[model samples]
Target: MPGKLTITRKISYDTFVQVMEKKGAPDSLAENIIAQRKYTLSKLDRRFVKELLFGSLRWYAKLYWILQKTSNRDLDKVTAQIKTALILGSYQIFYMSKVPDRSAVNESVEYIRYAGQANAVKFVNGILRTISRRAEYFPKPDKNKHPSQYLALQYAHPKWLVDRWSKRFNFERLKIILNANNQQAPNTIRVNSQKVPAHDLLNFKQSILREDKNTVYNKSLATCLVLKDSPNLEIGSQFAEGKYTIQDGSSQLVGHLVQPKEGEYIIDACVGPGGKSGHIVELSKGKAKVTAVDFSLAQINKAKTNLLRLGHDKIEFVCQDFLDFTPTQKPDKILLDAPCSGLGVLRKHPEGKWLKSPRIVHNMARRQQALLKHSLQILKDGGEIIYSVCSFEEEETIKQKEWLEREYKDAVSFPELSTRLPENYKYLLTKENILLILPGNKYSMDGFGAFIIRKNESVSNCRQAK
Candidate 1:
């Protein structure tokens, strides 16, 4: 009983196309596919799959423009599968130079044929072959003639994003920012100082202290380890033993800004997934009475798991919206790592560049202002609030700072915490004493902005006396 002439056995191209269309967000799509195939596919095949999926989406706009130019057809009228095939093929030719041109073209032609687009098969083949022959002849605006076009093609970013950045920053500096955005981010982990000393973690054999003088990760912490790449640190026996928790170097610094001390009461407003909360508990040697609160039940559940894994049982997890939640006891210190559009973390989440719009930033700013107002209400007199976001947008960082000053007036004062910062970071503080960690800055810190706001003791006294 021979199998009846089985011909095709590989994972279908249509399956990949379906996944991308369903996920919409490119990174999530790639991650979803990788997770699904992890048990079934070989590592080499997985790498190829990742490359094809990401490369197609990464260069989608440029590839489509080339398709429009070469085919002399409106890309809007193209069928979904055809468009996907063309993009997948053109990406290999332009970006994956190791792939043979004939193979890429032929495979794409076969894919189109399988999808019952036999008539368009010749159309796809001819256009791709033409592009192969005259790759340099595609229409591209000159740098002098069209600065937006130049930036879009040169950096492989959406034209709208390039236009916005060009207006916001100097053209030369924007180039550096864009280049950084496209690079792979380093993995950063914060030592759980409660269970294990930071110095001991540094002395561990698995890590190498980043020697880059410009890295904030190097200067800010007692010990910061930047792995050469993202690896499964959590799966290791050391991590399970509560040695350290994986976190971005910039994010880990937020706990330092809050500066919780032994036996103090701290409130982690909006503490979903509990990275900062865990770090705070660890830093305080488990003596700080920390209440971690968030609006999302799902995130709170995950935070609970993380806290348990880190062996942090003293901290309390409350599932309530910070805007509406009330504290049973006044917090000696509070941290509001507010929800943001996350523009500052483009290097880590490149898909965000395409998915987010300017309107989202505006809307998020409003929510952030409201959250900060509520966070200020729960702080004890003389308590400090660390308001932070992983975003560089002026609306989220600087504008929120201005709003806090104008609204809170004498009740809230920006503390001069820069003195505590390493000597090299003195320049990052504004005249008002707010900190702005810009991407591509001298520190190479993840784009983070945080301001330490201390409640005036006199105001606290007056409220308490009333």
Candidate 2:
């Protein structure tokens, strides 16, 4: 007998498709849903919702590959709504253990009916039943083919991405990167020393999960605390208390790279949601004249909310594009956490494989170039600038670094990263002043890159540096 439908999970699955099919990233889509309170979901309900939604979208490429084999014609010929039903059904059939196979097929057919795809009911049932057989439904990837093709099929990742990694990473390492992206990332938070010390957080009355076992690395981070198996810190009581900000280890390193001193004027150009800006304030002991700016008013508002929550009263927020907005005064230090293809955080945003590509990577590089060039205009001649992106694409990292060094020549100098990053992070440096973070178990950090350059004081007339 078939189990009764898990209606909430069904609803969640549909919404996930509604948003993700249009290319919405899971995090933002979930946030919008939660904020709107479209339905009252228990914690477990929300978890299942996320599980089904993320799982289907995360393994999109491979699941579609499965569907294509099970179908007579190309998958492109399938209607979007029916196709989503198939993907949802396939996720439970192959990936989910708790969902009984019968329940998976039955519940999916129910979704098809609810979607008003009564015509697809038999089609959905046939495909799902065939796939539920476990052996016959999913296609076996042939390893004898090129490693890129095998990895791409095995991991459900885009072929281009697989090909790109295969060339740079050995087969074993590439597999690690692909697998890690499919795993749940740790919930790491940096304690806001300006508001409360790490020790004080222990007594905050919230259910504290175990601290990261690597106490030495945790200590080396100064105030960062690693949490596993904890509630979403984004809305947890501790987060509300402004005790800490949820940030990735690699991103937190960007603050370390900035290494802002007391009384220095710093610009967090492109401060999205304000994670790094808050770190800057905390690092400077709230003494740095921090100006946080972003092009989007929405992003600027997020920066403001984070700054307010973290209890900083001194920073100024600006909702203006850094490319066009001229600063009142040249900042002594600038951190351009410029946007890029976000290739580094794929573990967090699995849809990236479907939503982003090499073309987007090249386009972002051009935008980053423009942002970097314009940012130099507002920095003091001798001031330092940190150009960082959450991408390891050569164009965004090394190529951009090369471009800056070429454009500035004697006017700009690249520093060695070892001089700034902690000992554990020094190995991440490819040169004196750049950090290319690889995603996976190594550091469990995102794929990120950063370059620090100092404007030449001798070129003080500096308009020529333009």
Candidate 3:
């Protein structure tokens, strides 16, 4: 009877714990997995769960501080499941006006019982009920005394991230950046220009083809489209016919910077999962000879699959690291889309905000520098190399650009990209005139830092001198 009762009552709670175990204790993961499970959650119920998970995780430190003040025992000594239940229940009581106090207390008590802790059910119920009744009496810290703490609690970010941004960016800009990361990322797709023209794709409209029928579609830009939601575009005939490829708006800008001409030969170093590499082939109108290289055979196979599905035969994918791969013919241009801490695209991948550290940025900067140096060697005389990273961190972006300037000196020329930028984005140009895109900008481009460097003719000639 106990086993049967447990099975019936614990199914949803067990699924939540399983998701937390697999995806870590991040609130977003919990919410996503729960929603995807199709567990009869009403919209309101789902919203409350999401807020509880994300809000608790976001301000976990402050919540733990509050818990410490209330209890005599160390918070860490508390069982993981019990702590999670408390956080969830406490969040509901404190934040969710729609969630009844009795439901929060009863459900949490049931959750503890389901976790094989029937002894702690009364404790759980009592604590949640007490907190619910005296919620206003909880000590609230003054924002003026601890601005970082206040922001950490309010926005649900770590104090360290808040402190880092406070020093690096102005308060207002940092607030905007943090707020953007907390929000859901819009789904943007890039038109497969080789197969479908942007204008034709946008003009041809059908209900099933539309991501959001209510949202207006723009046709002029070949680079990107921000959809209201992730559509079942894969099932659509247009997508099956290779009309477009899903890519972040900021990533679409990388192809624009590469500026692959119709007949030029281009090397896409570090091409993996082939989104941008495929975009390059599409942008070049199937006229450019593309050598897409990656370190992993698995990714090379994936690129091959994508190319095959799209009916592309012009692009050659090499399953070899760029550092070791030897090309039979020199490329007219090279695009080094180097790997780095993905700090810039945090809005799209909120999980990354917690995963990345400052040291990872430094390590990535070193790897990027090495890749850039090698890219210069492979590039042809007077060829262009676009160094790009999906990171706004100075160590990887501005600092890397500065290092390139000092190292290459007159060997490279930074292009005036502002002249070519979409009118809405002319102001993001750096002093030396490189393009640095931030989120919430006029262009709504994902945060990015790219440098379009043209190899000096004199430098190529000097190599000939040697």
Candidate 4:
């Protein structure tokens, strides 16, 4: 019953594979997203192609499971184009209800030919057509026989991750988390109040736009807006004018936590594309001096471009690994937005689940620990460090926090964040009161976790200030 793969000489998922393979390469996700902007595809074509690319990767595990059963061959034995086509075709047939089944199959068959695998036309067609009919029979991992396997194949996640989350969350919540991750996140951007308030852009007569009430949970964000629908619009109208930048609302919260004061000095570690670093400058009313550092020169250049567009000319841009780069001046505050498994923003980048593993998480946690040690050394005494990651993995989050607390028992402690969040979103806090935002939590926002730690400060003083 294995689906047959015809070896062909054509390339497929060219863009998707290129982006996916760049996993830990110099350019990060934000950089890739920006690079994608240069593509000449129309809005409709771009959306469709991107959806297929990201969607196929997001559902890769389940697709491979289905393919193995259908083809009777190891997935690796299949030609790359055939495999990519099958995955793309299956994703549309199963997950993309908006797409017509016949069209999905036809396009895939044609795609194989376009990939120069003319001989594979029938094989790709047959498997997709057969799958279209037996879709319900696939992804049927029995719950009673194998609960972890059930969640893994059914939810399209690595079995190890599902197992960990299964133990961490109740069954229902885990399902919600997985299902939310599968859904497309709305396109949201933070309007630059320093240049233009979000309200002024509303009904500005350039393009159709709507303000989603749930885009942001915090009133102080002041610049968040969710795009109602993907429409062809002029980048010159607003973005080119430095009126706003594409940033997730979840990311905007760290700026609020930063609470940068006018003329204060701040350092943004791993500040790629400069989204948060720009937010910090905006929050400080353009008075704060931000020193943004990144390990990649490419990312630093990209961040510099975005910063320039945001009217920032004087912010220091350092291209050096945070661990090796010594600061010329101690920062009054620092945002160690340390990179991790990216488990939290899976909804935004579902390819992560397919490309990441437990070993990667462990290694990253160790690396993050070293970065934290170095950051602490450069941090001025009594200055605050907003430690954060776009992931909920214990190795990258709570355990990391515990590590910091343990190693610096006499030197550091977390500040109370409950008072920092709106009353409705206060539930985002953990039992330890650490901020751990989950996917599809009240705001339908991306999952993010952050903890504010103030050095050389008493717990009582921090609590009182909060």
Candidate 5:
């Protein structure tokens, strides 16, 4: 007999519906929604809610495709409640092998009734049952004729994104990235040197391993750790005591590229949530004068709270647009972690595949160009700028680099780029001296593109370097 809707599953369903209705980032919105629940959920309950919510969003397109094949009704025409219930049920049925199909179908049926759509119970249940029966042999677009559509449905990405990527990579490489985006992202963290050196953290090996079985220190980057199978952390004593903060390995590399030094001032132009800013302060041992700037006051406050928790309250936080903001003195170095398509972090933020469009990428690239140009104005002579984005798109990465080189005669690649990196990481540098970490790389890092350019004593303008 099918069980009634459990509290955990109900919360997951409610959160999923809210995300769909609001069309907000699932990760962000789900956090706020779940936090508002009056009753405290168990650890397993929290994990189930996140898995169900994120997994449904992660494989949304593919689930919808399966439903369209399995059902006679047009999903778009169905009520939002019915559609979301089906997708959630189908996700568990197709991708979550641990979840029995009967439970998947029954819970969805119960959710529809729970949501006051008792009429949808039979409809959702019938479709989910049909999906389970035909799970192995669902229809797909013909690969040869509709390659983009085929890959989009097969990989659960937007067709336009798949089409764009298809042009830049071979079939095998494209598949690799698509497959990588679908896999679970690792819980990588950067150990706070101020509190506990990464090596010392490892010395607590028996305790660390006991807490997280899948944890491993990253040899190439001493301050980095990869917790392969753990969920996000909030209650851990290590995190509470500011020993480490969760940050992607690729993102951690940006601070390495900055190479903060004592007495030097650094500016993070678009310091969203201040991860790099915190890392810079840690790396400089609280000696570097850093100014973290962002346009949104909310983001500034969030960064302030986060950094204060990390025990670095000396750093300045400025809530102003990078283009208009200026410090009392020019910064020795500037980091432009510009906003882009976020194509590189699909594994972690799967909603981007559906929410983002190519137009958004082009718009972000234009903003990146503006930020890059302005960063040079506030940087001291002979100082370098570390430009990075969590995307590998041509317009946002290489094209921006080309534009800077063409427009500024004094802009030159950082001479010591190769030597600054660890020997194992030297291969990440490209022929143009850009640090390009494509998705699906062996490091299991998010795709990131970064390059360093130094300013000459007398900045010059060139018309034709392209």
Candidate 6:
């Protein structure tokens, strides 16, 4: 009876706790599970629950520190329900300007009581109350002496990541990236050109702008729109009709880089949920021969369903590992959107702050190297491959590119990639023609590293030529 968590009648709070307890799950999965709960939540209540769940996750470390400072107790030793309630309460007290501190403290104290954590109610109240009063005076790790700890606690990033990144990036730049990761990411959509022509989408933008000023056309991307405050897109007629697909501007760039021709065959390796594959179809005006591959059957099935919904049915769907799957026909181009540590997109998936470790990044780099090698094998002579990962880790990006050039004498960096980029975005391209998109750039895009490599000859030809 002392430490048991009781399901309270407050639907939103109960759901928030339930979602919080699902450790190691992706943020999206947690959101789905929360939505599937039996309780019917009002629109307002749903928003509150999501804010608590995601915001707490985003600032998990910072909230924990604040609670520890206020309570002078080892939250590590407290029951999880008590800690979660305290974190939720501290998030509102310190971060949510719209929420009254009194309300936050009361709700947390009440949730603890309802959860049967009678011993923690007083502890939770004292912590939240003290935080509400003296949060400004609370101490943080010294920036000079404990830079990693300071940045981690101040920005809610993993200390290991902060320490690792600090070695590669200057302090100012690392701080910029960390701060950007803590901010709300915009919802970017790639207009399905087949369904909504540029002129039609322009008209739709004007209409939506009339309703929501935060909605605006992307300056550099002709077929992209960004919503700083996104509405319920699933309910919108335009989204329902497949006029646009929810994708980040960073990912939309991958489609542009692929530049699938009308008759060219393209392979999207690691086609998770098929966003880029669908983009290829739209870019090619539904004329490119495309094959989407993923090792997970669930991912391939999801891609198949999504592509079909977007009116792209001719594309092949293969549920096999990219390393083993070879196409019957050689592809003119390949888009190896390989999986990585996902350190680049931490803003969108804040759970990574808690879930990811340096070891994960190192392990992922090894897999990426293998995927790149196998992809080169299946490509035709002179065919190009856009090697991409949603990561900025040196091991995954520059090192992988270097390794390809060293291992395969025929592999050369694409020469004309600079000419393909929009004028404004040419800055994203390095002198070597690699696209290095950092999170805190003016585009507000996720961090990503992509480079194009062309197989100058067949493997046997390469050997003979050497």
TM-score of each: 0.82, 0.92, 0.79, 0.86, 0.94, 0.91
Clashing pairs in 1: none
**What local lDDT score does residue 374 receive in model 6, on the 0 to 100 scale?**
79
lDDT of 1: 0.72
In the order shown, what is each candidate's alpha-carbon RMSD?
A: 5.4, 3.1, 5.0, 5.7, 2.5, 3.4
**Higher lDDT: candidate 2 or 4?**
2
Per-residue lDDT for 1-466 in model 6, tens only? 2333222224435544555566444445545555676555555555665566667778989888767766767878888778778877888877789988887788778887877877777778887888888645677889999888889998988788898989988889999999999877777888789887887876878766774454665657898788656544545556666667788888888887898898999999899999999999998999999999999998989888778878899989888999999899999999999999998888877777886767998899888888877777889988999888899888888788777777776545565667677778888887666888888999888899888888887765553211
Once fitted onto the true fold, the runs of candidate 3 whose alpha carbons sit more than 4 angstroms away are 1-73, 86-134, 137-141, 207-223, 233-241, 305-309, 457-466
Pairs that collide in candidate 4 are 1-70, 2-70, 2-71, 2-72, 3-70, 3-71, 10-115
Instruction: Identify the runs in model 4 with alpha carbons over 4 angstroms from their true place.
Output: 1-12, 17-39, 135-139, 197-221, 231-233, 457-466
Q: Report the C-alpha lDDT of model 4 over 113-195, residue by residue, as the tens digit.
A: 76688888878888888898985464486787888888888879988888888888987898899988988887677777787
Give the clashing residue pairs of candidate 6, or none: none
Name the lDDT value of residue 72 in candidate 5.
85
Task: Report the number of clashing residue pairs per model.
Answer: 0, 6, 1, 7, 0, 0
lDDT of 2 at 196: 79
TM-score of 5: 0.94
Model number with the top TM-score: 5
TM-score of 6: 0.91
Give lDDT tens digits, candidate 5, residues 1-466: 4369988778777777777777677767766766777757776777787788888888999888878878888889998889888999988987789999999999899888878988777889888998888754766889888888888988899888998999999878998999899887877888788888655766654455676454565546888877655633556756666767888989988888899999998998888888999999998999999999999999999899778879999988888988899789989999889888899898988877877777988899888888877777777888889999999888888888888777785555455678677777889888877888888998999998988878775354434222
- Candidates 1 and 6 compared: the better one by lDDT is 6
Q: Which stretches of candidate 5 lie over 4 Å from their true place?
A: 1-3, 211-214, 217-219, 228-236, 411-416, 457-466
The TM-score measured for candidate 1 stands at 0.82
